[model samples]
Target chain A: MSKKQTKEITESTIILPEDIKKEYTILNLGPTHPATHGIFQNILKMDGEKIVEAESTVGYIHRAFEKLAERKAYYQITPYTDRLNYCSAPLNNLGWHMAVEKLIGAEIPKRVQYMRVIIMELARIIDHIICNSVIGVDTGALTGFVYMFQQREFVYDIFEEICGARLTTNIGRIGGFERDFSPKVWKKIEQFLKEFPKVLAEFESLFVRNRIFMDRTIGCGAISAEKALSYGFTGPNLRATGIDYDVRVMNPYSSYEDFDFIIPVGTQGDTYDRFMVREEEMKQSLSIIRQALDKMPEGPFHADLPEFYLPEKQDVYSKMEALIYQFKIVMGENDVPVGEIYHAIEAANGELGFYIISDGGRTPYRLHFRRPCFIYYQAYTEMIKGAMLSDAILTMSSLNVIAGELDA
Target chain B: MLISQSVQEKLINEINEHFQDALVKHEVLYDMFTITLKREAVAPLIRHLYNHEEFKFKFLTNLCGLHYPNQKNQELGLMYQLHSFENNYRIRIKTFFPINDPVIATVTDIFNAANWMERQEYDFFGIEFKGHPNLKRILNVDDMTIFPMRKEYPAEDQARKDKNDIMFGR
Candidate 1:
């Protein structure tokens, strides 16, 4: 290679901008950055420490959950929902089940509905715990995150006892739980409810009044109520903007209407408001669980949909009718009514929705998951446009944009 | 319930009176009032709903593309679910277009949230949202030619030779 040839190649490749004054320093914040907890990237054009403009580049971990849902049977898709917001897998599982039930118009037992309420509320608590504590961690308050994570583990233990799986729990069947909650599961729930509030209060005390934490989060990355609504914000993120639009309250499902709980709202739509709103929500979720436990109903655990729900193991072996039903259910050959329905639940991060179009097939004709994180991430570039780079991390964490849910 | 049957009927009648035959059909599917409209009527109808005093469907809850390869001319569809916080009501609006010219006017102008949602529709099913500022593939790579969500593309890869039954000790 001649020196002249090397110089010519360099000149051709690196053409200088026509106006050098307009050129901004381009920095890739993440496809993987220590600050970004997930596998999404932000292309930030910088003016010193402040961001002149930021472009988010996501789908690095896109798994095509919608396309896969089309090929999977109605019951088989529950596991896929678990991956969407894995911080609260049971919520996704129940949301999917509820959608299926809506399509079939199956009547759920009151006891089963109450059981679902307890489980769903527990999931909401852990979801808020992760989002709030991570915001603390992002604001350089790691002590609170470490302290709150223990409660998350206790919740996970309760989940494991109920469903035999912790993270990606394909917990409940289409109609209801596969079996009744054991005495051990009840004990664990009692234990979690008793211990969780004290630790949550301690965690809240650490950051609610701390001067440095307040300074970092209070006015940083603020958005107005109108902008948040226009951006399709929901759950805690939307409530933080003072909209108070909760799917659970607006369109109650799974006995949520029976419980009395206030939807927490925050003003200014800043990172601090988001953190505080989630903290308050966790407390509300605890109250909802307590209420569900107090007014517990006594009835069958599973709904009367033997064609959809599998029969007992011993019955399947002994009886011909049970054997036929078992084979049909296992082979995904159960009859599904032809209809189109949309069901949304007040998931941890936001309104997690499932829109199903069935053509009376063994599998769904088309299924779409309205993942709230996907919408929230689309508004990220606009949210962090003029903010400092460090505040951008705090804003993203506070929004609780789970990558699996975002990319789905 | 946020919307009663009479309110839903009145809303449908109002939409029909204003838009004429733009509303192709309307039905109540599992308590949700769904209206199928002509493609040209979608963008304007959404804007109208957003600004209407009686029905302020100002928030877009969800939007996605659908494919029906067997449905001859109308191979692609777009569904938009909008909610009115003031009334606590929701409605599903749908429009269909042929695959050869899969174009529908963008709703990003009405709802900023539709920007990425339209991009996602374009990305997966190749339904082009006209007038969108940056209409490009979102969830897929830029250079990929195939729209993965279309019915022609199977969910499982048919070309993988490594996953034969013999290899799995079956």
Candidate 2:
């Protein structure tokens, strides 16, 4: 968010003489301005209120998670993935865990699969609520944004019950969950399931049919399905373009095949379609969570790989063998496999892929995170080429470009 | 959807007939078939898959680069993941190059999404995406010379004088 880079980048454009006939005026939309929701800079050439051209610059918050992943052991990298999309940290954690589990060829149980489905669906709901309500807030519907945000807090309460943290949740293990869902946690999820739909219905009642909101969003920042596909969109953004390419449905990982759900898609890839797709997805997510909970199997939560997972506290204290294994696991002394693997999941935003190259060592040789934000953000200048400047903000919010994921 | 036996054989046969000179090997890892080839043949193969009716790899899932220092001349490699929306099958293409001159034909013309991804690859691994439209820098600052993702640089900041290896148990 430094002003230095903004001035440095825009120096050439701003120095033009005012007396000369100029059709467009250059404007720094922001590196530090509000409405971006994160540290981002878009130098826009504006013709009155319309954007003639837009050049986006990211990497303000690039912590280099890929480089960091190379130095850490398999389990140690879980906490780092949490920061990628902080709005839906648990999903990122789950994706990273499943990727490493694929590399290790570990066998996860049915109960663990159901638990992960429930947790990830909750994350998808929370992520969509944020995007949709923020869309309302951006379009001047403050009450609906506030109402949905209040409901989002309840979703956070569910996350807090599942994991200890709220924003950057470092939850789940490689093979499965760190711990099983307790009865109290299940009660909270049940309570959330019962209470959230009313608030969501109230939220929908306020905006879905409203004239002013519809006018502002429809046909604004629209892109064709072909362009969206060429730009490498996935998840809700690509679903808004009427392409049903979900990672879960296409490639079922960890027993996603057992659950029953429908993939919601929208006809036009505009702000309205993206918002409505997210709205319908929240309902589908509710159905998935209900199915997962109703048929929740009973078994061990974590996988049976003692070399990867730490032993129970009771066993670690009582048995010397358990203590030795736990010590070796923590210190990165375990034998990892030698192979090249690519694993992806439908993250809250899109397809988040982790490409790992292992040389039979404790640490990965090369770990590249195919971050969706980094790919889709490239198409921003094209999306907002000739649209109004305000619609640029709408398109960005609808796309849900997390800075952590964008710059990782 | 699961890369059926006949489709896999057809893909291999097509590559064997046309791109035999550039083909290195093909193996299945994590249940997805990965085809390794020479670096120069990547863009041509990507174009072929998109245009051919039998393959229909219309959507590019991802494009990234990696460095393996142990492989003497083949230190840098690029990986492309393509997905067909209709058939619901996936294929991965990997190509290796020498670190001293890591260059590959750009696929920006075939897949417009490759523009920034190639720039990111260039920014991190220093792999030149020849013929890229605006291949400058996407993520990192423009003035940076060193490719920070290579094995030469340490993960932690070397300027951190206060940190100790004892704290990290190194």
Listed in order, each prediction's TM-score against the native is: 0.94, 0.93
For model 2, residues B41-149, the per-residue Cα lDDT tens digits are 8899899999989779998888889887889999998989899888888999999999999889999998888998899899999999889988887778899999989
- lDDT scores of the candidates, listed in order: 0.90, 0.87
lDDT (0-100) at residue A202 of candidate 2? 95
Instruction: Note the residue pairs that clash in candidate 2.
Output: none
The CAPRI category of model 2 is medium
In the range A1-408, model 2's lDDT, one tens digit per residue, is: 856654455755675667568688999977877899888999999989999988989889888888888878899998899888888988989898888888898899999888989889889999998889888988988898888887778878877877788888888887777787878889988998998899999999998899998999998878889998999988899999899888898888868888888888999999999989999999999999999989988899989998899888999999998999999999988878998788888988899888888988998888888888888888899999989988999888988888888887
Write down the worst ten-residue block by lDDT for model 2 chain A. A2-11
- Residue-level lDDT for B144 in candidate 1: 92
Runs with alpha carbons beyond 4 Å of true place in candidate 2: A1-20, B157-170
- In terms of DockQ, the best-performing candidate is 1
Task: Give a tens-digit lDDT track for model 1, residues B37-97.
Answer: 9999999999999999999999999998999999989989999999999898889999998
Native interface contact recovery, all models: 0.77, 0.79
Question: Given the true complex, what DockQ would model 1 score?
Answer: 0.72
Error of 2 at B27 (Å): 1.4
